[model samples]
Target: MDADRISKLPDHVIHHILSFLPTIDAVWTSLLSRHWRRMWYYVPTLEFSQFGNKDVEIFYNFVDDCLKHRMMGMHHNTMSVITRFNLNTVYRGRRSKVKLDRWLSFIAQPHLQKLVLNMFEYEPVRRRHYCLPEVVLNLASLTVLKLVFVELEACYPVSLPSLEYLYLGHVQMEDEILHTLLLGCPSLEELYIKDCDKLKSLRVSSSCLQFLDLSGNWETFTIKVEAINLQSFAFSNTAWKKPCSCRFDLASCKKIENLSLHGVSFYPDEDFASFISGLPLLESLALDQCDLIDIRNQHLKFLDVKTVRYKDRDQANWDEEDWDKVDWDEVDWDRIEISIDAPNLDSFKCYTKNLLVRFLMNSPNLSETFIHVGYCAETETRRREREREWIIVLIDVLFLVLLVELLMFPQVFRRNCRSPLPNVNKLKVEMGGYDEDGVRDALLWLAPSAETISIELEPF
Candidate 1:
């Protein structure tokens, strides 16, 4: 197609294509022709990046030109805007304050829905402050807000009636300031706080909050969450000095389905188990590196009357003497049952081989059982050491064959030899064939097709 013909596409189509490009690239389309010059101004999404140039003058000039273009043809509201203004005091140090104020004032439009501001290493250290004007709070149309490395002089305690998701990363604020913000957003559903070292306590009591993530903190912190409508929750890598405590007493969350806890420690298992058992409709539970206290007996009591028959022993002569020989004390059997309880009991998985065997032999009602071998570096190292010893014997036969070839068939080797003799290195590798055998044996004892075996090993 001809250039003129291609350029005659609808303005909406042009803006749609421009929306995918960086804001600077889209604005540069102004040089294409007069028709395309103002078209970039109407684009819905705006993204600007200032890199390599330490001078703030370049940033101010670029922003000024874009804003001037926007105002010249500005009629309708823009959908969303994402701007990354990297400023340095080298060139625009004298006009830094004026430029900063102007930049914030330019984008403080009520029509702006999503606003993202990222400023890195702006100088004139004393003047380096971001003031969110009261007009920002009045932007009722705005929903998602993200701020990075920006300091707020006063907590913008404005109610966001439309806000659903809020993310604050590396933003400094006091506990009271954060609480005020949370209290203002009545309809907030998801909140994420990461690397916010200044925050000490997060007191969240929202009726609409369904998901919450608190990770990466420098100092001790506590979170008081009371969300009756909450369904899914995740906690990762957060520390507390005096044992942080949280109370989840909301009963309105009857539909609460999934719970995931990562890198968290609870003092008492009874309290946690009781809370979990109360959720009648709960479906999935995931615990990763979580410290659960004294759960063995409680789990056994929960899975009462589930009988296990040893595959090697005949069912007719089964007695207590057969169970007495089993190492009941060493087997942490309760964790396996808790892992498998589905609508009471269905399937379960265990990391330890012995525990898995005991659970299979004990749980008569268990429909499926999975034995996951711990394949971390320690286990891999041990397996590799054994494999190396075994593979060495196999390689010895190859070495003898090579030595015989070199002595008896020197002419044959010389005719084919463009390269030197290959290095016979004894490399260590893990064999999953053994794990498959174990799974087969376990399956033979249980229902023939009831048990499925799968082995996943760590990458070399």
Candidate 2:
């Protein structure tokens, strides 16, 4: 006789196994054995996904069937106090909203902890965005809440005391609503907001915030973050509004250990040097498509600097038409210089187009180094336009970017000085420009004693 080994397992064990399966699939397992029927109902988590269901009513009915107090009718409540619920569904009309509201109310048990609602509006009938049902924010047991394409209702003061992590993506939230919403999450440790609409000014004064990531949609926005315990913060508004606007202000989050800034420039007049000096606890820093004059830090361990990250909103490759749009005469390509002074730095990475940068101090303890030079055409269209030869173009690009010079540490550039990264254990170099054997050989000169060397070439 075949062994029914899975069904022979204990009730809790079966429930645990079933928790990983989809709610519908878990429910289907009930038919495998008579005893297993009741066990699936006790699983602590439920996940339902209707990937653009053509029949919205059918999906709603399925969820209602599964969550409806079972045979106990309206009075007894769910069989088990579900801890987590994830619903990725399409919002069709009032009926879908009504069903979602009902389900939210049904699952608002005190034991519920994590709630994820990825509701996308069906374009044809999306007359208005879905306003979040107020009951969701009142869950005191909630810890991780992710709301996408949902609007927070400004009905009253919402409270989620136990919330530790929150993600708001494409969420329609007003300034006052956000302030009040954050005020309620006193224990929130990590927060991520991307494409949040209608936000003019954001004041993050949370004492418990340790990590914050503001991804984009900062056309005209001012952010003031004053947190005591924040460690890692990343802000990327790739849609550059003004060349040198001081819209972002970190209220000296003194304990921050890691920082990343993209699509922002704070140069000489803006006093960016003083801004870096203010953060005494910063250990690792990353600057992308940003203008920096100097980086003087004592306790710094890791540094990453990139000039041209994306081509037309992070596109992979650039076409001929886009290349001709640049007015090369206006941009001071060589006037700007970046000098770094971090003695304890361990790892360094530089990805650039063509710019000059300097490292004021030596990195004796450096173990890892990475360099990526990229995205120029083969035609030499920008350099000489008429000269179809590649050798002359390669020479011009090689001599321009200073970060590569600092890494390669060739004898020609510096007369008396030795290589700063002599003890590097691993070296990685990526060339997006036309690859010649000389380019690879040149990058490997500094790290002569490196244990491992990786060279990647993506030639245009």
**What TM-score against the true fold does each predicted structure earn?**
0.61, 0.76
| TM-score for predicted model 2 compared with the true structure | 0.76
- Name model 2 segments beyond 4 Å from true: 69-79, 124-127, 240-246, 267-269, 309-336, 355-367, 378-460
Tens digits of per-residue lDDT, candidate 1, 316-410, equal 14354664454433322222223322333334443432122222133334444333443222245554543344334324322322221212223
> What are the runs in model 1 whose C-alpha is more than 4 Å off?
1-5, 52-55, 75-100, 120-131, 153-156, 218-221, 238-252, 268-270, 293-460
Candidate 1: 10-residue stretch with minimal lDDT: 293-302
- Checking candidate 1 for backbone clashes, the offending pairs are 340-347
Candidate 2 C-alpha lDDT tens digits along 24-74: 899898787678766767888889999755776788888888886332322
Q: For this target, which candidate reaches the highest lDDT against the unseen true structure? A: 2
